[model samples]
Target: MGKMLTVTTMFLIQMIITFETSGLYAMAPILSNNFGINHSSIILVNIGFALAGICAPFFGVASEKYGKKKFIIIGVSTFLIGSIITSYANGATLFLVGRSIIGLGYYNLSGLLLAYLGDIVAYSNRGKIYGIIRAASGIGILLSPLTSTYLISNFSLKVYYLIIAFITAIILLLSFFIPKVEKRSSYKISTVDIILIFRNRDGRLFLFLNFSMGTFLVLYFSYIAVHLEAFFNLSALNIGKVLTYSAFGTLSGIFIAGILSDRIGKLKLTKIYYLILIASIFLINIVNIHFIWIITFIMSLSFDGGWTIIQTISSEIIPEERGVFMSLVFFVVSLSLILFYIIGPVVYSYGGFLYTTVLSGFFIIISYILFLKFAKNNTEKFN
Candidate 1:
């Protein structure tokens, strides 16, 4: 019962974190109006979050040395505070400060949580567990836009932040009840440990793959809402409704991939997922406004599917260093966001959405090739 409570509490944390992350995208336009900022400035929220995540590797190492619970507590508390600050921010500087804090807290909490799971769960069942956890997290992404839209439409956007802050506080309290796990090792992280990660072929490939996927997904998500409003003239509520399809797709993909990968193999499923991902992005360029939801759904499904598989693979590669490995993966992902926010708008302005979409797909194509060449036969061994 205690174990179950821990998992349930973590699941709720995942949901709230995911919701807060996705909610920023949904609130972009409203934020722009509220703070009187431009597109670039609005994207700073994402950039700020990514910048903070640069500390993930360090946080991961610290968690291994100190323990996961302390970091989880710090993460939850920091996120709650950040959300409160963001909810009441009246200027761009304050908003960015709040976002940066949220980013820092998010990376610490999430990285440690994955490490915690790696310590407790067996490798054989990791795929299915990841699927379940991600599926739960997907609910947040699924509901974020709709909930944000409703809140913004009926009440005010600030209400969304307050609600997340309140729930996160509750989750923090529940976190104290998580049963402690034995630390895997007492060895402190060093330069050798960091270097060894890249020395492994699988680790290097996975990091690069994560970087590519992060770039592709961020580019798509960072612009999709704005694109809908600009190209299709959709209202905020309608945009939220359309975005909901992506969430549905994400949920379906992660749940199905989770189960199937355990049977058919995570690598094999990833190959198919990449193909679908590529096709979906290309289709988005040509699809009519009415069909946007379907394309976006396919995109979300394929993206989430591939993401889950890779994460499972990362956990298996260096089971002993699972925390650091996951942290590195996310570190690259965060870097991608920083890079994209800086460059994505320029690409969109110069070449339009078609070019930007194609560019995003192109990165995935490279990732697919890398996966086939290196990870095709890489399968997890059960301990």
Candidate 2:
């Protein structure tokens, strides 16, 4: 396939996956209603996505050993099947079982899309394209909450999932346009080599940053809908509107992060991004703002946008094994979510949501300091 066609194909497919992941938040109430459960318990559906994340490393390795094109096709197909099952599920356990299948597909699907980008783009332009592709994720982010809210409020949850499932079908058709990429048989690395990836010093930092950022982002999205409904007394429609506005901020953050990463050094820019993320979270937690909607919008932009920069840096950090590295990053992120999100509501139940938010930020601060101490730039050339 031609470069432009390939890029366009990848962008659209990634957006579908992104929508499925982020759109779940807007559908939380609907999922609860369908399953006859409460919102907090229904939040575990987000945990299913994270569980998929933990499996990314295995997918990363498989993509490298097999071919990216093949994995993308399989992953997308599996996601469609999973979504269909989940949509028809009559109970919470069956709903999660369906979600788990979709989740497993997500890891490979997301990892390969990124690794494919890493293969096509040169080092200098990688960050920019990564940002642009990431911005497409926001398109799905913008659509999911609003679309789900409208469908659920006006129609039904079953209809909403069916619509998204159809969209996923379109995404799968577009997957054909992506160029095929085969793993380097001679360059194949063992599980031991994967372990040695952590010994790279900077690799460890990259992994930790990936983990920390994942914790904060997932926690925010997982519960933001519930918070809006309970604390601010916003309806599903208004929540979608609020999320759409915040997505604009996130969109801007993504583009600017890419531009800045190219101009500034990746490391310096990432450090600054983390600081911005920390400050934004602090404001949300510490301030007693009555206009909670405005705060949520601003902070979502800062936090999500800043993390895009971190992701760009990560895509750069372990360039040789982009698929594997990204997989590990996704895995760590999923691990954190399963541990945090599964128990987070309990923490919120007793300690308050503010406590969990503050704790996530503190973890970011700690991880940032460690990354600053150990992470280093690559001297190896990529053209």
Candidate 3:
């Protein structure tokens, strides 16, 4: 019962954090208006978060040496503080600062939670368990936009932030309920340990694949809200409705992929998802406005599904070092966000959504080829 409570509490914490993160993207239009910034400038909020994520690998190592629960508590508390600041911010600089703080907490909690789960769950069932947990987190993504849109339209953007902060505070209390796990005996986690991760062929492949895949996924979500508003002339509520449909697809994909990953193996499933992802991106580019929701749904499914598989593969690669490995995975993801934020606006300005989508598809194709050439053999070794 205690174990179940611990798992449930952790899942809820993840769900709330996911909600907060997705809400920022969902409310991008309103935020731009509220702060008098352009869409391109607003993206810096996400970049700030990514910049803070540079600490994830180090935090991962710290979690192992010190303890996971302490870091989890610290993370949630930091996120709460950030949420409070963001809620009250009247200027762009303050908002970005708050977001950066949230980023620090976000990566810490997300990375350590996976490592903690890896400690408790058996290797055989880890994939399915990750899927379940990710699906739970996906609920936040599923509903955040819809809820944010409704709240922002009816009330104010500040209300959304306050609500998030309040809920996060509640979760902080629940986090204390988390059961303690046995810590590693060695308190020494040197730079060499992290460097050694890259020495493995699988590690290199996973980093490259995660970065490439993340480039597509992050760019799509970060700019899609703006695209719909600018290109299709959709209202904020309407855009949120569209994203809601995509969120459903994300949830379905994570759940299904989780089950399939355990059965078909992560590598094989990833390849299939990659093809679907390419098709979905291409279809979205050409599809009429009315049919875009369907295509976006497919795109979200493929992108997020493939991401779940790859994350599972990453965790399994160095099971003993799951914290550091997952943190590095997130680090690469953050790096991709940083790169895309710099270039995404330029791409959108020059070529618009079609060209941007094509560029993302190009990245995915390269990632698929890399997977086939390097990761296939090493990935199969574990599966």
Candidate 2's C-alpha lDDT?
0.75
lDDT tens digits by residue: candidate 1, 1-383: 98789788888888898898887677777777777866544676567888988999998887777778877888899999999998887777888888889999888877677778878887777787778778877899999998988897798757878998999989999988997776545758788879988899888988999999888867788778877877888898888988898899999899888889977877788888999999998899889988898999999999998898888777877877888888888898889889987888788777767777888888999889988876545544421
Highest-scoring model, lDDT = 3
Look at candidate 3 and tell me the lDDT of residue 185: 53
**CA lDDT scores, all candidates in order:** 0.83, 0.75, 0.84
| Clash totals in order | 0, 0, 0
- Report lDDT (Cα) of residue 351, candidate 1: 75
RMSD of 1: 1.7
Off by over 4 Å in 1: 379-383
lDDT of 3 by residue, 291-348 (tens): 9899989888888898887877778777767888988988888898888888887887
Report the candidate with higher lDDT, 1 versus 3: 3
Q: Ten consecutive residues with minimal summed lDDT in candidate 3?
A: 374-383
TM-score of 1: 0.96
